[model samples]
Target chain A: MIELSDVHKSFGSKDVLRGVNLTLPKGESMVIIGGSGTGKSVLLKCVLGLIQPDTGSIAVDGQDVTRLRQGSSERDAFLARFGMLFQGGALFDSLPVWQNVAFRLLRGSLKRPKSEAREVAIEKLRRVGLTPDVADLFPAELSGGMQKRVGLARAIAAEPEIIFFDEPTTGLDPIMSGVINELIREIVVEMGATAMTITHDMSSVRAIADDVAMLHGGVIQWSGPVKDMDASGDPYVTQFISGSADGPIETVR
Target chain B: MSFLATIGRTVLGFLAAIGSVTLFAMETVSHLFRPPYYPREFGHALLQIGYFSLPVVGLTTIFTGGALALQIYAGGARFSAEAVVPQIVAIGMVRELGPVLVGLMIAARVTSSIAAEIATMKVTEQIDALTTLSTNPMKYLTLPRVLAATLVMPVLVGVGDVIGIMGGYLVGVERLGFNASTYLRNTVDFLEFLDIVTSLAKGAVFGFLAALMGCYFGMRSGRGAQGVGRATKGAVVAASVLILAANFILTELFFAA
Candidate 1:
């Protein structure tokens, strides 16, 4: 389980996160939806300890994350249980696809023998619908959708207990987006991992989210079960859901 | 008052840059003794910064040495002191041209490449991905390149010094009507043990600065293609300037007495 209390962050004078508070239970998929530049990514990075908050606390599995020092063994252990899929595929351009998937297994605490790691990578690739023939190919050789699949394979290869997806379907076609959303939903359910996703795509929100939280003005404006999202009654939620330019939420920056 | 304020801001900015680079170098050195070392990455960096750099280093030093020979011979002829060509070339190449030229060449070639590659990775979020996979970017990316350059630079300098002197030897005997044995004898006899040592030591310092600037700028790069371009440019410029500055300092330390 993850809990954030009054989390506040700012970049210079621009307040990105202003007293955000939320809870994500174990084995549940929660998708945070907000407009561009709304600090959705910042909020996710804060939880991952990639960005330090100015105030408040973020607890993952009942342990305070903000206090974890970088390069500490405790920090490594904390990160070992989590996986992240970036907006871009973010695959290592220099390494082959299989090596990328098996990256976690090839080193660090979760290391395995080379042959075993390669086999696991191939299996994960298969799980993500990539063939074994694609294993030796570099990420630059893959198309956008294929790269996303490769990224997904890498994310799940370690079978992390928690997974975060950042704008997973941002650049894919509608069909590919649907396929990826389906894959994410299935993977989260199959692993029973606590999943936190940030995206503005309504289709993706509906497809992947078990619970939907609307982030506006750096706070969770409204949050409820996925079924309640359509009828949440909050103006910001309604405006965002309907993709309206006119609403309580300002369109212009 | 406004002009003074602008000057003040510029001075502060320059100081801040120095402070940042100093901290970065210290952090890299700290990580050197830490566990979870990446030997494979180190090997790859060695091959990239050392082996792949040979052709360019060789070509640059050889031409400079040849040019230095011609110029020295021309100038000495005016003084009726043409016998000094071989000795002057030996001292010039060994003490200054070899290390300085090799350092600048590395700044142009290796520093620019490292900066561009790492900056692109930053823009694309590969560095963040490495962090997610429990790999420290400093350990995986910066340490290897910096360490390899620091160690291999002396070797490159040594090679450049020999090739450069050979360039002078060829010019002296084949073009300047000097006997081959006499030119070789004059070149070898003029060079001292301390000259060779200081030259290699200068090479080590230049190499460290060049790779350090590359990793420093690359890691701090801003967003997109413009960011990568700016980082690469900054890296080469900073590395070249630092190499020149360091060369002067090392020379003073070695020969100021």
Candidate 2:
């Protein structure tokens, strides 16, 4: 389980996260939805310890993540249990597809032999719908959808207990987005990993989310299960779901 | 008062930048002693920074040495002491031209390339990916390049010094009516061990500055194409200027009367 309490972050004088409080139980998929620049990414990064919050507490599995030092053994052990798929694939351009997938296994605490790592990478690639031939190719050689799949493969290769997906379906076409959403849903279920995904794609929310959280003005405007999202009777949730420019949420930054 | 405030702001910014770079260099050096060293990355950096840099370093030094010989001959002739060509060329090449020229060449070639490559990596989020994978960017990226450049620069300088003296030798014997054996003898006889040592030391310093500036600018770069462009330009300029400034300081320390 993951928990956040009164999380606040500010950049200079501009406050990004005013006060965020949320929780995700184990083996659940929670999707966060908001307009552009609503600090959806910042909220996720805060949980990952990529961005430090000004105030608040984040705990994963009863361990206070805020107290863990960067580059510490404890922090490393903590990070080992979690995986993240970036908004952009963020694949290493210099390494081949297999190496990128097997990166965690090839180095650090999860060190494995070269041949074994390669085999594991190939297997993960297959799981993500990539062929064995694709292993030898570079990230640049793959299409955006293929790269996303590769990123997904890399995120799951370690079999991390928790996974975070940041705007996973942003740049893909509708068909590809559907495929990715289905893959994410299946992977989360099969792995039984606690997953937190942030995206504005309603199709993705319906396809992948077990629970939906609406983030607006750096706070959760509404929180409920996927089925209750439409009938939640919250104006903010209604405006966001209907994709209306005219609503309680301002369109302009 | 407003003018004074603006000047103060600029001065503070300058000092802050220096402090930041110093911290970065210290962190990079600290990683040198840590575990999980990447030997393959270090070897690749050696090839990229040292081996690939040879042709440009060689071509530049040869032409500069040839030009130095001509200038020294013309100046020595006006003093009715044209026989001093071999001695002056040897001293000039070994003490100043060889190291300085090689340093500037590296700033132009290796510095820009490192800055551009690392900056692009930053923009593309590869650095973050490395961090998530438990690989420190300082260890995997900066240390290998910096260490490779620092170690190989002395060798490059030695090679440049020899080639440059040969350039002078060719010009002296063929174009200026001097005997080949005599010019070569004069060149070898005039150069002291101290001059060569100082030259190599300067090469190491210059090389350190070159790679350090590249990594520093690259890691701090902003987002996108404009950011990468600015980082590359800033790195080359900073490396080149630091090399020249360090040359002056090292020269005054080594050869001061």
Candidate 3:
């Protein structure tokens, strides 16, 4: 299980996340929805230790993560258990698709000969609906949708127990987004991985999420199963999902 | 505007910058010799730092050598000693032009390229992606470039010295009406091996300095396009200044006595 309690974070004088609390049960998919400038990404970064909260407790499996000291072998072991798909595909431009997919496996203790790793990479690519021949192409040559699929392949290549997706369907065409959403749903359910995704696409919520949370006023305004998401009744969740700009989510500028 | 205060501020800033760079350089050297060495990346750096650099460094050396020959011949004509052309050309190319020209060439070519490339990577989240994959950016990117340049530059300078001297030799023998044997003999007799050693060593030092400055500034560059541009400019200026400053200090250390 992943749990965040009273997380507070600010950038200089601007408060981005204020006393936000949330929990995702094991082997379930939780999606957080918010406006563009809302703290959804910041919350994810905080969980990944990319950013530190001012005062909060973020625990994975009940271990306090907000204050976890890093770089120890034990800490590295913990870090290795989680996989993430960045907003941008973020594949290494220098490497071909297969190499990018096998990046983690080709480093550290998991490293093997190039042929062995490439075979594993190709299998993972096939799982994400990419041809083995496409593995030789660089990231720059691939279209946006292809890159996103390659990124997903890389994320699940090592098959971590926990995974996080940031804007998984952004920049994708409707059909491609639906395909990616279905793939994400299938992967998480088949692997029984605890998953957290941050996005505004309600279609993604319906396709992949089991539970959903709404972030507003630097806090989680409401959360429930995807079945109850439409009737959340919280004005913020309603306005946000309905794509209304004339809501409580005001622009300070 | 007190002189001591001004001097103190400059010294303090310089020290801080050097201290930070020293720590980073140490980290780079450690990572270079450590396992998980990226041979593929090193080959790419070799292509970028050495192979692509040859034309620019060669062209600069040839033109500078020809121009130096003309200037020296003209000045020596006033003393009826224009025949000293070949000797001075040989020494100039071996002792100074080879090292300084190569240094400046790398500062302009390699430094800016590395800085711009790394800054782009930083802005586009590639470096962060490397970290997420558990690859150290310095180990993967910076060390290979620095190491390749450090190893390749001396050979480049040695080749440039021969080419620049050929430019001078051709000009002196054909245009200045000097006997081929006399000019060749003078060049051979006047140049010392230490001159060659000093220049080559300086070339290696300068190459390392240029690439180091590029990677350092690029990594430290602020976010956004404007930040990347500023970092690229800063890397070029810093690399150029450091190369010239190191040249003078090395000259003093090698021959001041």
- Pick the DockQ winner: 1
Instruction: Report the candidate with higher lDDT, 1 versus 2.
Output: 1
- How many angstroms is residue B38 displaced in model 1 relative to the true structure, after the best TM-score fit? 0.7
Selected candidate, larger TM-score, 1 vs 2: 1
Q: Relative to the true structure, how large is the alpha-carbon lDDT of every model?
A: 0.94, 0.92, 0.88
What would the per-residue lDDT of candidate 3 be over residues B146-165, giving only the tens digit for each residue? Answer: 99989889988988998898
True contacts kept of each: 0.74, 0.43, 0.26
Candidate 1 Cα errors over 4 Å, as ranges: none
The digit string of per-residue lDDT tens for model 3 on A1-253 reads: 9999999999999999999999999999999998787889899989877678999899999888767664345545666787788888888887899999999888875678889989999999999999999999999999999998998998888888898899999999999999999999999999999999999999999999999998887999999999998888888888878888687777553
| Least accurate 10 contiguous residues by lDDT in model 1 chain B | B165-174
Q: Arrange candidates by DockQ, descending.
A: 1, 2, 3
Indicate whether candidate 1 or candidate 3 has the larger lDDT. Answer: 1
Q: What is the TM-score of chain B in candidate 1?
A: 0.99
Overall local distance difference test of candidate 3: 0.88
How many Å off is the CA of B121 in candidate 1? 0.9
Query: Model 2 off-target regions past 4 Å?
Result: none
The alpha-carbon root-mean-square deviation between model 2 and the true structure, to one decimal in Å, is 1.3
Cα deviation in Å at residue B65, candidate 1?
Answer: 0.6
Error of 2 at B125 (Å): 1.5
Give the alpha carbon lDDT tens digit for every residue of B76-137 in model 2.
88989889889998999999999999999999999999999999989987787677777778
**DockQ score of the complex predicted as candidate 1:** 0.86
- Clashing pairs for predicted structure model 3, backbone only: none
